[model samples]
Target: MGLGVERFTTQLPEHLHCFVCLDVSYPPVIVCALEHQMCESCATELRKSSSKGKCPMCAQTMLDPVRTSGVLKRAIEDYEVTCRYTGCKWVGCLLDEPTHAKSCDFREIPCALCKTPYQHSRSVQHMLVCPEEVVLCPQGGKRCARKKRCELEKHLSDFCGQWQCRVVQGCDTRTSLANLPAHEKTCADAAARIAKLEEALSGRNETLATILTELRAKLDSLDPTRHASPPRFDWPAGQPAERTVSTCTLVKQLLTRATKRRHRRATLAATALLAKPLPSPHVAVLQESAPASPPAPALA
Candidate 1:
């Protein structure tokens, strides 16, 4: 009710009590005498209710009906008092009561961002997910400056273009989309592209190596000298052999020359296809020359 009279170390004078409410009168109104004062709230109510133009305590005619006593208000505020909120142990001069009420832990206050009421003690917890609170864009926050916490997911996928690019070959750099014109020049994505290119080239080389091996095998199979040995015939008992081994030998010689020419051409084509140097370490280098074919068997 009135600033607690019990809180003060020394008892206040009897004149300080309002004649109407019988409580310690704050903002005491001086109606007639200094000894007969009423609380401003009581005086104003009585003025409107009853037109008795007389001071209730001393039966004296009311003169100007003045309602405020600055001296009494100051006297009341000078005394120390404890906080009114239940369980709050804070004690201070009455003048500071309004300031302390705003920050008391047990009191409820509205969030500045969302305007939702919550306990002052929970301010830190409330701010963590407050929809209106501004926060970094979470997906590489360094790029985009700010976003509302409620919009974090939308900002990640739709709004913010900057992202943590894929790391490649132990490079831990990140590049932004804002500087996309120079994207290839930046080492971050450049390293990633290089890694992808190497993978593709490695597979191509493996395929090329297989093709070259197949071509080499086909060329060796076509060697005429490999079939140069003459087949033995079942001779008639009385007749001389119509065809001599020398005749078969001459035919084989012509075939060997023609086969050699084709082998040389196939080898040259393979070499041309593999002319460029392979950069990937995973693929073995293709040599310029194939291993020499075993010397052509002597033509019969």
Candidate 2:
């Protein structure tokens, strides 16, 4: 036909050996020991026996690269891979290698249902329907559907629990250290006592007025003239008893009796004036009268 197809063939076809059995035509590319290679699973198994990381076939350090053909590498890039495990069922592109490794078919995640560690592919499906994955009501001693824990606590405290039974009765002020126990015992008692005292003081105002009136009356009842005794006359001394004393004594006695009568009348008048509640003018009169003492008796 056109010159035989074989004429166009080059070494590219010849080097296409399965890196594994070297039996197949195509080999997948993989990385191992910092080198590019094919058949990674076989290389990994081979690593167990040799701590040196030597290649199984060549006994060379597995650090040696077994580069896959550029053409095969490009072909693998176009294909998608899926895990073969039954429930696992993760599927993604070969080009997404790093991403797949991070969240991959073989990766592990804890199960929501059983809490058992299972493959990520299966765990994702299990979590969707898992009973344990359901967030519970935190207020009632379980995780709540409400997003905020604080809100849940408020709801339970206000609406759900026996909060009414826990109602606080009195004001909640912190008493000073010196007054705490005394405040507790007599807080209400002290308030009541203060109120009673205030009421007594306010209501007894008329009684107080009456008492003041009585005190003023008693003070007014005092006799102004009673402040001093009646003046007394002295009998004359060193005189002859018969010649000087007889007529003088008789006259002195009469004058004394007359003076006593005048004094009694003055006292009666002052007592009556004071009893009538004299104003400031009577006080001046009383003071003026008080200074007049009787003249000293003539020597007999």
Candidate 3:
């Protein structure tokens, strides 16, 4: 009854399902909108409706049925299927045209070194390490564009000899690759930094020694003077003597005081040495040699 129907029917084989209204004998074209048929009437109604007119049969909006072009429909029905590569999960129809090609990730790029197929990202990375991808010298030099690694080394040394050093904050001096090892060996800034470190260590050691010496001297100056001895007791005749004693007890107390002071000084010096960057060994030895009590005179 219509060209749209003819276009649709011509593409399909002799027997296939068609929309119920568009059959050749009863081409009455059942209405989805006023005087419209082929079930597309509902789509026209929905398109014109204020709130999107729905299908009269199901009361669902009919404006957006999926439409397939003739080419696409035939391709899907007749397409033979095979996966492009082993282990691919896809098992169904692959169109011969560029429909699937738009999304396919298997496209190839030529290797810059050898015009062989390689993936684009992988080929770029390979070029970074590939010797054959070497750039030719614009100057008419006898060396081939892809010079052997050994010959390239020699050529670069003789010609573009200024190789960058590996050091961070590197030396600015330019030298041939052959001479880089020697130049780095005697780099003056590196040597100066080492000298400064050595000097700082030496100065710290001297300061520690001086502090320890002064501490020992202070410990030695503790009082060694004698305290008052107990006075002799006078005795009455034939009576047991009532013995009187001076403050010998105080002398013992003084000795105790001196011992504690010596101990405190030794402890302080030990702590000071521990606080130093490098401790002097003599501080430990000196602390061990401290007298347990002051001299005999002080004790008495």
Q: Which candidate is the best by TM-score?
A: 1
> For residues 1-300, what per-residue lDDT tens digits would candidate 2 score against the true structure?
111112111223333334554422234433454444545445555556445566544555665454555776565445455533334355554455446566566666677455667677566666655545543344343422432333444455444432221122454544333454455566667667878999999879979999999987787678566457788655445545545568867688768878999999999999998889556887898997897788999999
lDDT of 1 by residue, 63-134 (tens): 565657788878877777777666678889778887998878868778998998877777899998889999
**What Cα-based lDDT does every candidate model obtain?**
0.72, 0.53, 0.50
Candidate 3 C-alpha lDDT tens digits along 77-174:
34344434323334443344245443444445566556666544355665655555555432224333545333465567566545555452456766
lDDT of model 1, residue 238: 50
Stretches off by above 4 angstroms in model 2 are 1-37, 50-61, 64-71, 80-93, 96-109, 117-300
Candidate 2 minimal-lDDT segment of 10 residues: 1-10
Colliding pairs, model 1: none
Alpha carbon lDDT of residue 112, candidate 1?
91
Q: Give the Cα error of residue 255 in candidate 3, in Å.
A: 44
All candidates' TM-scores?
0.34, 0.23, 0.29
Error of 3 at 60 (Å): 68
Q: Please give the range of 10 consecutive residues that has the lowest summed lDDT in model 3.
A: 1-10
Clashes of each: 0, 10, 1
Better of 1 and 2 by lDDT: 1
